[model samples]
Target: MQGGLEFKTEIELLSRVHHKNLVSLMGFCFEKGEQILVYEYVSNGSLKDSLSGKSGIRLDWMRRLRVALGAASGLAYLHEFANPPIIHRDIKSNNILLDESLNAKVSDFGLSKPIVDSEGSYVITQVKGTMGYMDPEYYMTHKLTEKSDVYSFGVLMLELLTARKPIEHGKYIVREVQETMDQTKDLYNLHEFLDPAIGLGTTLKGLQKFVDLAMWCVKESGSDRPMMVEVVKEIENIMELVGVNLDANSTSISASYEETSKGNSPYPGYPYS
Candidate 1:
């Protein structure tokens, strides 16, 4: 009975929300205690699969950045554009899916809750989210807000850069990245932390900017974090810096991803080690 209620809630939420970057609900089934949600088929599977090497497809630097932007756009829409403003309480890589062209689409809204502006800016409820991706403030105060999603997205950004799980071998990726940044003031040291498969040594400037944005999103205080709208703008700027013309057309971005992946080493003369 309780499971049925949760399913109804998710259906009610997803049915009313529509965006290019969010998974579209096709239909649902609720017969004989069997409940199911039919969503648009996303061929590329979850972002977690891509990062964990289970997808069999390599997400190069450009692809990763594009995925990040797409996810951010979806979240921005949910927080800013959606009626009543929805908060995706569970914003983790596993919930972010990709299509055949590798375009990201946020999915799994079972834990989502609508923000009642009248009650307050935040919804005080039981903290419900994945372990590694949950926001500290939300966990501590049980005050859920859009910023909690930002914090989880920050962890997602780190996963994209490092191609590592949020928690590997009992070590938190965010803490590790923060410690590394604290120790090394030079951006050149970024190569040491970034995923070697992307061959991102030449893209230091853009990567550095992305790191800065991620750090801001994961700040201890929700007030310190940038809004989702700001996050989208920053990602757009980063895409621009990387010469990705997202406005051109889908074909253009696809071609760019192909070309960027051709040369194994995006930076030939630059030192990778």
Candidate 2:
């Protein structure tokens, strides 16, 4: 899936879009049936690595928030500002890379689609994406929309908090978080779910709001999800609440892409202002 048509598509799409939070395409080669795309070397590994403790980069709450903001800013630009607009069919933590500063850069555009170039609002096509991060609605009806990415991003948000894979040991993070969440208790009674490195029983400003927003994005239905632009605003507001500079940046717990898909899934208007 990373060569030929998909490879060229990735090259073309990356060539057209440029953003600080997006991995930059340096150059490429496609002669003699050989294909290569050279992108700016993002020093730090993927967000998945950091969260899994494989990258050895301790992610505190602020750094994690900044990483989330950077990824959201990149997606917002793709969904709103790209000339023809784009929908990243995959939005998992693995596709999010980090630079030396630990600022996130959205990578792996192999599955990106120009939402506006298609027939209209939503592009109807065979759904292709990572197992845990695929959108339930998209997987169901094959209608790829901006909100699909939102759903996947919601899962990524949960990954940030829990530092757990979307699905681990047959337990889906979305369902885990959904069942564990109890608004009546302190920290939503999510101490067990939260990554201890984020600190324990300490006053984590904006933690509740952050959890609420993540749940909102993962609503079972796409329409119930917030637009990427709206997500950016919410993150920015959360950052401000957490005392991070608003000037700087930027989940129901939908059923597993497995369970719902085994049973039962719009594009966006461009130039949202």
Q: Judged by lDDT, which candidate is best?
A: 2
- Where's the lowest-lDDT run of ten residues in candidate 1? 264-273
Clash tally for model 1: 0
TM-score of structure candidate 2: 0.89
Please, what are the lDDT tens digits per residue for candidate 2 over residues 121-154? 6888788998777777788788898898998999
Candidate 1 lDDT, 66-154, residue by residue in tens: 89988987898788767788999898889999999899999999889999867747999997889888887788788899999999999
Question: Which residue pairs in model 1 clash with each other?
Answer: none
The 0-to-1 C-alpha lDDT of every candidate, in the order given, reads 0.81, 0.82
All predictions: root-mean-square deviation over Cα?
9.8, 8.3
**CA deviation > 4 Å runs, candidate 2:** 117-119, 247-273
Candidate 1 residues lying further than 4 Å off, grouped into runs, are 117-120, 182-188, 201-205, 248-273
Residue 161 lDDT (model 2): 92
